[model samples]
Target: MVVRQTVLVCVLAVLAYVGLWALFSGDETETPAAPDAMFLTDYSKATTGSCVKFNGPGENDLGLTVVDCKGSRAALKIGTVLPNTSGECPRGDYKVLRDTRHNAALCLLPNAEPGDCFEIDTEDIQRSVVSKFDCAAPRVNVQVVDVAKESCPEEAELGVPYEDLTLCLRRVR
Candidate 1:
């Protein structure tokens, strides 16, 4: 009977030690959760009677027609004025406006008219534009989307026609 009790005690002690080790050693190997989806907004300048063109990182150019232009926004669609693209923007199927000299483009919903422009903060736009335009490299004309009125505050002073705009972009995941 004593031997049996001794053996049972040893087994219980070993189990307790294991449980304590597991509780204290922090052996959890689970990865941290990824961030939630985010949207970045930006604005584009439209030329009168000229369709705004957007080129994807893969060298596909998309054209968006300007139905009506207000102070800073224009209503556009894919079939109404935008030309068919061999390959469309990876973001979605809609018309987006881009600068003639810039690689960054604004993701606008179909038929987005002036004053109907959705508001987006600055950081999101920067991340989205950098991801979409591949601005990580050096290029003669680095395309940058303006999300804040103050982002390019000096553009007006320098005689550049930059405008305040917004965009919505999700995380790549």
Candidate 2:
């Protein structure tokens, strides 16, 4: 019985190896071509100044899509890109996205602009994603007066500090 079992196992192993070899040693199948540059969605290659729509932390999906800076879908700008093992983004304010599989980190800046309005997320201030809206809109509670300026004007009710500058905001509520 032992001899029969050993012979059966050896036969099965030989069959498995032959099957795997036959599956891989094929010239009939053509290798797939590389994807086009425009269709590539890898955000790890994004550089400073590139605008992106990111899926922030705590969300089920985590990735980014590069978009036009002037477009409404652009939520953040790449302040800088670094390795996942690198230090934090330069102090002030920034949303950091680290992709462990890719070994990359993206320092993102809010894509806020003058005349744009936003709704603040109090629960997680650092993860508060900004989206542009009309100042007169009902949900628009904060309006930007100036960005990256020498200083926020005295008339501005709130001054949100950011990298190298301050965003002068006025209460819309």
Candidate 3:
């Protein structure tokens, strides 16, 4: 009887071990997934005519990502790349981004299209950002009439020179 009991115990131990091993073992063909690639743009190295996408909030936020110039995510275009010694962007509606750490600055212009409406900041144009709005919205005060116009028409309230063309803006409110 003792011999039979000892043999039964040994077989049970072997079965338990095999069952546990089978439960823990996963598919051998599966492999650990690779980490996602992180892409960071060095705004200081950005060149004139390159397109960028805003990455953070507020006008002072310099976080930007370089993207395709013709892509849908392109929000602003680099009009001029300046050194920190330049002080500020050229006079006009251009937005200024200063990178003191890299001693670089960028003059940016909104990638706006004709017929697009916007709500501009009348108090501080430099602090204003480009956010397109529906033409019928009550908050929309400015409208883009022509993007590549040489000169704005008499009806246009503001004209922003970008590259070789002029952005003819009219008061919509």
Candidate 4:
């Protein structure tokens, strides 16, 4: 009777071990999932056509600022939402380039108009660009659109004195 009892206990232990192993083990083909990516600002606060100032173009860590288009450091007016604010805004002349890294969205003035294909190199377009200028003057010419298609023009020996670049399209001479 003792021998039978011992044998029964051993079998039960082995079965229990096997059951636990099966329950804990995952499929060999399964892989751990990666965490979701995070952005700096909660863009949900913004609306379409609202004027906004995005701090950083890359990684968007600095966050966003809603500014007056007239007096503030307004970069772009929110247009048809690719990624931008969602609020009332003045009718914009052209769309500003989307800088995902900065989380920036600024538009040119209604009076100012973009010219040829403009290739924006910097993220701080508000600081880098001017209001409007003649295209012949050598500043970068731009045609703001909902989506950016054209590439930045190749730079030749030609270099301007280089001051504030026009955020609004500067018409060429």
What lDDT does the true structure give each of the candidates?
Answer: 0.34, 0.70, 0.72, 0.42
> Higher TM-score: candidate 1 or 2?
2
Model 3 C-alpha lDDT per residue in residues 15-123, reported as the tens digit of each score: 9999999989886887867433213345567778777767766445547777765565565778887867366666556788777777788888876778777777644
TM-score of 4: 0.29
Order the numbered candidates by lDDT, best leading: 3, 2, 4, 1
Q: Which scores better on lDDT, 1 or 2?
A: 2
Candidates sorted by TM-score, best first: 2, 3, 4, 1
- Ten residues in a row with the worst lDDT in model 4? 156-165
Residues 1-173 of candidate 4: C-alpha lDDT, one tens digit per residue = 99999999999999999999999998688676742222225454345655555555531435545555553335344553434533332332343445455354444332222333333433344344333333444554444322212332333222221112223322222
Candidate 4 displacement at residue 59 in angstroms: 9.5
TM-score: model 1 vs. ground truth: 0.24
> What tens digits encode model 1's per-residue C-alpha lDDT throughout 122-171?
23322222212232323212222232333333332111122233322222
Candidate number with greatest lDDT: 3
- CA lDDT, candidate 3, residue 114: 81
* Model 4 lDDT at residue 160: 22
* Model 1 alpha-carbon drift over 4 Å, by segment: 28-30, 35-163, 166-173
TM-score of each: 0.24, 0.66, 0.62, 0.29
Per-model RMSD to reference: 16.7, 8.4, 7.9, 15.3
Better of 1 and 3 by TM-score: 3
